[model samples]
Target chain A: MTGMVAAFTATILAAGSTTLLLAVASLVVATILGMGAAFAKLSGNRLLRTIASAYTFVVRGIPDLVVMLLIYYSLPALLNQWIDAMGIDARVEFPPIVAGIATLGLIFGAYMTETFKTALQNIPKGQIEAAIAYGLTRRRMFVCIILPQLIRLALPGFTNNWLVLAKATALVSLIGLQDVMFRAKGAAEATGMPFTFYLIAAGFYLFVTVFSLILLALLARRFEIGLRELAP
Target chain B: MNWDVIAENLPLYAEGAKLTLLLAVVSLALSFVLAVPLAFLRNGRVPAVRYAVLGYTLVFRGTPLLVQLFLVYFGLAQFELIRASVFWPWLSSPMVCVLLTFVLNTTAYSTEIFAGGLRHIPVGEIEAARAYGMSRRAQAFRILIPGMLTRSLPLYGNEMIMMLHATALASTVTLLETTGVARRITLNYYIQFEPYVTAAAIYLTLTFVLVSGFQLIQRRWAGYLESRIG
Candidate 1:
């Protein structure tokens, strides 16, 4: 029992931080891609709309596990071959973090696109029109008129996507990323207490998820300040 | 771009597609059966049991299904008690392990979906059923179950497609479902995108069919539910 406890502690020490790092990095990357996709979907150009829609449809249909494996194992070989043909003797290999982040970012990007698009549509059109008629620059209009409401409206769906994405970082282990899940597996093998170690990993994940929900709720409250009942 | 490569491996892909369907359909059926009773038990007057089931659903929802699968497949075997039990032999099989994980995971998600549908059941309907001199069992059989299933069909359909996506995780447990076969074909052929892309195409077609089927259900039933609730 003591051995299992010590092994779990060591496993958490070794890989827990990496797991958090992966989730945060991928979440940022995914949010950017999602914003881009959302804009492309809403843009006037037919080709952009078609491309964005197709990207989302493709991503949503396939599982993230397949996408992650493809990016990790196959993409490097494909890239390296091209690099070799360019008179470079060097090979290209993505570190597990890079591959995990990029694959997860791509997968979650589809979900966030829908969240963003729905949020954008819910903004009262009179508000955007008023901002435009007041002669604000595009940047100014976005910052001053649109951004605040967007954040408020997007928070609920964003919270859901963020929770799901954070849990997904666990899958990075399958691609040889030494995240908490990976370390826990090693601990299970070494200590012969697979349940003990796996339980520890699940605890860490549940903690991250619960913590995120609390933080998101606070953020939603902050963004929802004016519209809520402050009956004082 | 390599149509020839996919054409050569069509049989392998077809085999994979079959397993994927089997895994998803069987598990989903079991989840539906498990979820209906759990949905009722979820709100049963016993706070202790209710909280226990809620905890079960919460754990499943709060963590990744991959971890849950690993916990069952690899973690449980470490226990001497499990190894000595009759259940050990059942859990020893990979396909059984995968099916159990999917069934448990889908049951949790579907329980929430069905519970939501149950919440939408108007009180007056239950009273009407009671006033009509119907027994509790008859009321449940004649009205509540049908009403809940009908109302939750759209959400349940989404859950079913999610289950389809989840069959990809079976590959991690060594089941050669669609995504698993794709990985093999990719590594063997030294082509990354071709096999995975083909798998994605198959998955997309399945999802399209699922969505259309649900849309038909929604059109038939949404008007009925909206009038009852709205």
Candidate 2:
């Protein structure tokens, strides 16, 4: 019993950090995919737009749990088949963290694309015209006219996606990842103090959520001043 | 690729889908019933009642639904007092436990949405109601409830769709909903991946349908205010 208690206390903090790490990693991946997909959706090519929309459609439509399960359980066989065909001796299965981040990143990437695509399109037409008339390069125009307002406009949706993504990091526990949730479940099972451990896990999630809100608000405020200077 | 296995289990998947839909509907209906009054109470002039609802919403909204599910499903059984209490029979069943959790969780979220809508009711309108000597019940039903529900319909629709997605989590608690049967099918036929695909397809289809359903409902009830409502 004492040993179980010690293990529970030790894991609570360690797993908390891992969950944060997972959320951060997933956010980074989502950002990259979001930007790429957003550009694709904005492009003149019909095929590019179709593919981009399809990606977002399927991802946004499906539940996160189903995706997580599919990625974890279904991908290994395909990887093995490829490895065997290539004459490699090694076998491949995603580490639980790898699968968790990949699926979350993909799922949230679709949401980000929606945010980015709409924000990009909604930038005032006059701003771009002014930048072009000033003989600015495309890159310069984007930097001067598009990026600032885009960030300001996209901040609310971005913050929402991040909060949701953070909450979703809990599902990693279902796939056998030793995030705080998994550890809490184990402790609750062993110590027979489920209410305490699970409540603590909930507290951990709430703490991260509240802290992220503060950080994101400060970020939004930072960009908001630039927006005010531009438009106010 | 195992068409045989997937084909054989189509009925089972359908059953699982039915379970998922049933669970979501029951949870959503109960939560709505509980939330309307709670929303009214929270928006009332009483600070104490408002704060109590505030705390309830904060805790439920702050944490993940998955955590709440585990806590309610597993946590309640840990207490001898609860086990000895008359409510133990309901709490002991995973189905009821999950329903209880969903009702509480959705109540918190829906209350906020409803209250926000209520808050948007112009103060002038309330004063006008009072000036006309309208009773509180008359004012509530005729003015407040009608407008609030109309304005909040779109947002509440989104919440309902989210709750529908959350039914997927029922599998985590060992409930044999769509996702649960998906898990079982995957285990039973480790060589085949079609079951997972089928499950995803089912969820995606349901989401589109629900999204369209919400659109139709909004178009019907709040259609006249479409220029302002959505």
Candidate 3:
């Protein structure tokens, strides 16, 4: 009995680590996609703006699970068709983990685009004008002026997105990613203690949430050091 | 690509959509009913009562809804006592379990949203009611609740849409909601794209309808508040 309990504990912990890795990797992908889309939407070009708008609209409209399932089951087939059309003899493999991350990244990218666009817009226009007046290049101006304020402005929304994304990692288990949820389901079946195993799974998620909340709070305070609110 | 498969499955999709709507609407209605009183408790004077409500919201909001669903659906049946209990019949049904989980999950979030709305009510408004010699019950029912609910409309609309999307999770437990129907179609046909894409489209339409409906409601109900600002 002790041996069986130990095995379950070990497997769940290992699976929890995988969940964390998936969430972080997807967050990175989402941040990059979101940043590009935000810039595209904010650009002067009408076509870019329209395309970006459509991307966010469509992606945000559908549920994340459906999107994940659609991508997981379809992408490989679609890729194979393209490969066949090209007369390539090689087959590309698409793993469930990759599908999970990509779909999550794509779906959350829409949300992050909105968050980033708002953050970018909230940057005082005069600061950019002043940076140009001071002869700073666009790159330097963004790094020195926009990035800091963007971090400050976007952190709250970013934290919210991160937390949601972390919880969303559980959905990847449905696509056979063998994350904590999958492990818990297995343990529950094996031990006939579904309540105990599922409770532990919830504990794993709650731990991540509470830990992230504390860390993000510290980060927020760090970024907010020089900031002061205007009197209401 | 398989137009034939999609066309043949249209009725199944419609039936699934109906179930999806039922799940979303019932759970949202139930959550609203539960959340109103809990929101009031959250805002009430006692620290213990407030903290109790906060803890419920924190746990529900912190964990994934999938976990909560599993805890109720699969986990609850693990106990011999529950299985032997009078409620086992209702608890054994996937539909009941899903609805119960969704209501609990949504009620937690809605309570917080409504509580925030309550806190945001201008203190002066409450004071004015008091100064007018309104009874406590009158002040609560006539003034406070309406003001909080109106202020909560936009956020609550968001929660409604979220609840709608969340019905997709019901598929995991063998409920034939929209996503479940899509999954079944895929299993039968061995074609992935058509059924899932159809599901996505259905969800998109529902989301659009909900958004427009909320906009109309917001225009009529919350219009005055925006007008004051402008």
Candidate 4:
């Protein structure tokens, strides 16, 4: 009995770690894509703005699982067809993790774009003008002026997005990723105690959520050091 | 593009779309009913009641809906007591289980949104009601509830859209919702892109409709605030 308990614990912990890693990796991808899309939406080019708007609209409209399944099953099929047409002696494959991350990153990237856009707009326009007037290089201006304020302004929305994204990692298990949900299902089947195993999985997610809330709250405070809340 | 497979499966997709809408609408309506009382309790003066509601929201919102669904569906069957109970038949049905999970999940979120709306009600409005010698019940019925609903319309609309998207999860538990039909087509035809794309298109249209519907409703319900600002 002890041995069985130990094995179950080990499996769940490892799977939990995988879920965390997938979430972090997908968040990094989402942040980058979101930043780029935000700039595109804000850019003067009409085509860029339209494309960015369409990206967010379509992504936000569809279900995450549907998108994930579409990418997971269709991308490789499309690639292999292209390979066959080219007479290449190779096949392309997408591991579940890769597909999971790509789908999530792409979906949440749309959300992050909205958050970043609002944050960017909230920054005083004069700050940018002042930076340009002072002859600061564009890169330096962004780094020294825009970036800090953007982080502070965007943190609340970022925290909300991150929490939602972390919870969304559970969907990856449906595609055969060995995340906590998948492992919990496995354990449930093996032990014939689905309730216990699933409850444990819920506990793991709850812990992550509570921990994140605390961590992000601290980060928000850290970013707010030089600012004061206006009286309501 | 497997046009033949898609054409043959059109009826199935339509049926699935109806089921999807059913699940989403039923769950959203039920959650709205459940959320109203819970939201009030969350803002109630009693510490224990407020905390209890808080605890419920925390657990439901913190954990993924899939886990909750699995726990209710597969986990409950593990118990002999539940199996022997009269409720077992209802609980055993996949549709019931999915609906139950969705209602619980959406209620948690909607509770918070509604509570926030209640909190944001201008203090002056409440004071005015009090000064007018309105009874507590009258103030609640005429002032508080309407204000919260109107103030929370936009957020509630968002929750409605989310519930629609979440109905796709019903496919996982053997319900032939839109995504379920898509999955079935993929299995049957050994073709992936067309079925899922069809489902996506259907979902996108639903989302667009919901957004436009909410915009009209918002203009109707919250237009006074807008006119004031303008």
Candidate 5:
């Protein structure tokens, strides 16, 4: 029993850490892209709005699995074209990690664009006007006022997005990334007890999700403290 | 760019699309049937049953559907006990496995949606129904279910569309659905872009219909809920 427990713990740590790292990096990439796309979506320029809208619509409409597979299969060819265009002998391999991060980031960024856009809509228009009236520059207004409020308004949705993105990291295994699910699959096949190993994989996911929920709740509570005292 | 290639593959793609629609609609219908009862059970007085349903939903929702599909398809198939069991006949078909996974996954999601709607139902409504001498079962079916359905219809529609997108994962289990057929086309011609682009176009079209359909349902339910208030 002790030996089995040790083996399971080792497997969970081995897989869990890598998957969590990839997921966090992907979340960072997705957050940056999503902010840009959300801004473009809210821009007055019709062309920019249309382009951003199209990206979000198309990406969200398709399955993440399909997007991952397409990217995993096609990114090499796309990169090869760039390498060929540069007229260099240098060849770079797109590892499963790259594919996983890029694809997951790309898809989640589309979803986040909409989430952030909705949050942006909720901010009163007068706040921005008041900032401008106070002689604040556009950058200053965004940094000092708009950005903080936007982040707070979007935190709940963003937390949900982060949860979804974490679960999405499991799809990385489908593309041959040696994440927790991938390692679990290998162990399951080796051990011939598919249920046991898969249950362990599920347990790992539950642990991450529960831990994340607690952290999110704490962050949300911290954000609410002063606001609640001010409320009715 | 090549209309000719798309035209030639039209019928094949349509067949795949038809299969995709069939798989999604059938599974969604099954999911709704399963979810309504499960959602009610989750809210019932029985602690053990409620917790059991909660566990089932969590396990199904927390894990990736791809893993669950694989476990169902290959895991069960590999087992001699399952193979010898009478259930093997239903389990043998790829379509069956896909449908089972789709139904299970969507049921977990929809039960939560339904449960949310159920919670939002005012206690006053139940008290009013009780005052009218409605039986418990009558209150559940007539008042509670209708209120839940009206409140949940829009969210449930979104879940259905999400399930439609999820059906593409069925391709991973070797079911030759739309995406799978698209992959086969790409493999056969060594032309990757056109087939995938075509498949994506088809998916977007389906999503368009899904969104429109959900909007209509939302409008209908809005009228019903408003009428009840009136």
Candidate 6:
């Protein structure tokens, strides 16, 4: 018990921090990439539309676990070769943390791209025309009229993607990151009580996800205030 | 890029792919079979069943699949009762435990999807059926189930693909599926890119095939429903 307790703080810090860091970085990156992809998807250019469509279709079809594995194991080797060709003696090392974040961001960005694209198309065309008629510049129209509405409309799907992405950080342990699952595995093996340690780990995950869900709900409610007339 | 190494291991990789496909298809079938009844029970007037499904879905959806697989395989082995029971034979096999966990987990998720589909069915249709002298069982089987299945197909297809990717986790429990084989090969050769890429290609191909099959199923089911209505 003392041994488990001794490891508990370190385990929590490593797992919690890594997981939270990955989620925050991925969310930011995913949103930006998603917006780009959304624009590409909605663009008049056939090549841009096809590029975005292909990305969403392929990423959505493939399992995220495969993406994580490929990025973690294969990416560094490919990078190292590139570095060697560039006359750098140092190995182009990709740490597990960076790999996890980048791969997850890439995978989930494909999902969010679709969500944001839907939200973008959902906006009334008349509103954009009205903004244009008012002599609003493209940037001003996007800032004042489009982006806010897109964020509000995309919030629910974005929240869902966030929760899934958080849960997916567990897979990083497979590539040798000492996250919660890694520590839990160690404690379980040492104590010979797999159930107890795993249950604790699972509880922590549930807590994080449930807490995030509550925060998302609050955000949704706050957004709803301006549109309360539609509320019953 | 080592053609010789890949050629030497080609048969082994093929076997791994076979195991992955088997695990996915079997688990998907079992989950779908189990989910329909569970969905029915949850919607029925039974508090015990409803709460049971609620708790089941919460635990399954909330926890990571890796932990769930670990708990079922390793955690249960710690129990003398589980070891001593007649069910021990089935639980002893890693594949069985993986299949069991996958089925139970997917069933919980799909039941929610199924219930949502059920809720979307027009109450007027059921009422009209009753007025036309349709029995409850007949109404449910003929009208409710088919209607729910139609609406639920697309979401269920997504779940199926998710399950395909999920089978990769079975390697954790000593199952030598595709990812499992890739891990072992990577450990041996210390050259990661080739093996991981191979596994990823296999998974990507499977995903493509599964999506296309789902599209066909959707079209076929839609036509069947249309013919019935006509």
Best by DockQ: 4
Docking class of 4: high
Give the winner by TM-score. 4
Q: Kindly list the per-residue Cα lDDT of model 3 for residues A193-221, writing each as its tens digit.
A: 88888898999999999999999999999
Q: Write the per-residue lDDT of candidate 6 for residues A83-115, one digit (tens) a residue.
A: 888999987667888888888888889989988
Worst 10 residues of 1 chain B by lDDT: B221-230
Tally clashes: model 2: 0
Model 6: DockQ score: 0.68
Q: Show how many residue pairs clash in every candidate, following the order shown.
A: 0, 0, 0, 0, 0, 0
lDDT value, residue B89 of candidate 5: 92
Sort candidate 3 into its docking category.
Answer: high
Q: Which 10 residues in a row give candidate 2 chain B its minimum summed lDDT?
A: B186-195
* TM-score of predicted structure 2: 0.92
Clashing pairs in 5: none
Worst 10 residues of 2 chain A by lDDT: A1-10
lDDT (10s digit) by residue, model 1, range A28-57: 988999999999999999999999999998
Which one wins by DockQ: 3 or 6? 3
- Expressed as tens digits, the lDDT of each residue in B1-230 for candidate 1 is 56699999999999999999999999999999999999988877999988988999888888888889989999889888999999988898889999999999999999998988888788998999999999989998988888888889877987898899999999888888899888888778768767877888889888888888888878787667668556
TM for chain B in all models? 0.94, 0.94, 0.98, 0.97, 0.94, 0.92
What's the CA error at residue A85 for candidate 5, in Å? 9.2
The B-chain TM-score of model 3 reads 0.98
Model 5 residue B100 lDDT score: 90
lDDT of residue A104 for candidate 5 = 87
TM-score per candidate, in order? 0.91, 0.92, 0.96, 0.97, 0.89, 0.92
Candidate numbers, best DockQ first, in rank order:
4, 3, 2, 6, 1, 5
Fnat of candidates, each listed = 0.71, 0.75, 0.86, 0.83, 0.37, 0.69
lDDT of 5 by residue, B1-230 (tens): 34577679889899889988999999999888999999898898999999999898877777777777777776676578999999999998888988998898899989988988898899999999999999999999988998888888877887887888888888877877789888888788766556777788888899898998778877776576767667
Q: Candidate 2: list runs displaced more than 4 Å.
A: A1-7, A81-90, A226-232, B122-134, B228-230
Error of 1 at B101 (Å): 0.8
